[model samples]
Target chain A: MTLLVTVFAAIICTILWYKRKNDEMRLGTLCFLFWGASLMWLGDAIFEYAELHEEFFTPAPADMLNDLYLGLSVVALAMILWLIILLIKDPKGAVRRALQKK
Target chain B: MACFLVGAAEAIVVTVASKAIKASESKKELAVRSKGGEKAVDALREKQGIPWSRKLMWLAYLLWGGAFLLAYEHVWHGEVVPWFPFLTAMNDPGDTAEMLHEMSTVGVTMAVIVTVVWALLCVAADLILKRRANSPLENA
Candidate 1:
């Protein structure tokens, strides 16, 4: 259920970002990436919490699956930060010109 | 809860910092243009008439900062649950709590490092942007 929600959220945000490509597009893109990663992280956290509480009995395979999900979340976050740095940097030609002026 | 609060504070700090940097940049720009005989640029120096979009950008910065803080907290310490769940595979409640406390120490350290790096990057980006904006082709 949590995974579904996360995927849905990412889809919606991505759609919105594409729709606004010219208007603060970088900001929109960064936001979409950030939220997408966040939702995924939230989903895994929910699953881990459930496992910790023993709400769902998980076999060895399931435990491994949970670990994989957690690892993905970390990777997603790192990507989000990279996206942010790109967003914050001056847009393409803007940076090159800025550098030339210096 | 502590993480959330700290995140909120961080949001405010980032907002203020971004605004200060922008204002300074604009002032410097005005000073340059004024010296170059562009009297019209002096009007911008008053700063009483900043555009609405810039204001919105500042708000966005605040929101992003808050979200970053929230994510940092969530990663270090599990989200708070009102009642414990019934999963046996979970970490022990007592141990979880202890781990969270320890996690906060790590979180603080990480936050400081990330924030410093972010600030430095922003400064570099700003300088680069300013130079680009001042270029002759851009001015033309």
Candidate 2:
């Protein structure tokens, strides 16, 4: 479930990254984050499949819900970190301009 | 159970290397600044493309982010514990061996994949920067 969510996020970020040629937002970093997480989850999924075999196909509803939450939380956390980086870098200089106005 | 440790370990090493590279780059920048100021620093940057330290730091960030999420997931599954010998698999010899195997296989594979992706990204960025630098409009 977490893997699925991360893969979805990765796909969305990749699309955004490609669409925004100027890349002022630095969406590449977000894409990297999601893709990296997806890769890690893929490893976990492989091991879990090996251990559970056929049982891997089925997951408890509560566990699925928990994983969904975890996945969303991870995405949100990545966005927050990216925002912090953007603010620090201020590639657009929006923050700097706003501050100078005060 | 402890597979994420591999990525975490690599992240730690890469992060240390990145810090060292950053320090060296800063010293070089200082030297350039002393000789010719901000313009010299800008020229050096244009010549260098992207700093190696920044590229390495990006890899470190990716690895650490993956490692943290995996660790959290393992903890959620109760495969990891709060106590000493933190991984639950560490309690038993068979599980320990299996855990080590997983780390060597799945963990290492994931780390390699992430590293490869980062390398490709770095290469692509360098190519784009090079093209832009070579373009006629930029020179004018």
TM-score of chain B of each: 0.41, 0.94
Q: Each prediction's TM-score against the native?
A: 0.39, 0.76
Summing lDDT over every window of 10 consecutive residues in candidate 2 chain A, give the lowest-scoring window.
A28-37
Across A1-102, the per-residue lDDT of candidate 1 in tens digits comes to 323334454566557766874654364544434443343335345545555766433447765566456545544664576466765665665656866895
Off by over 4 Å in 2: A14-32, A45-70, A76-102
Docking class of 1: incorrect
Q: Candidate 2, residues A1-102: lDDT per residue as tens digits?
A: 899998999899989998996978989778767887888888778878999999888998998899899888888887897899889998999999999995
Scored by CA lDDT, what does every candidate get? 0.50, 0.88
Error of 1 at B48 (Å): 13
iRMSD in angstroms, per model: 9.5, 2.0
Q: How does candidate 1 score on lDDT?
A: 0.50
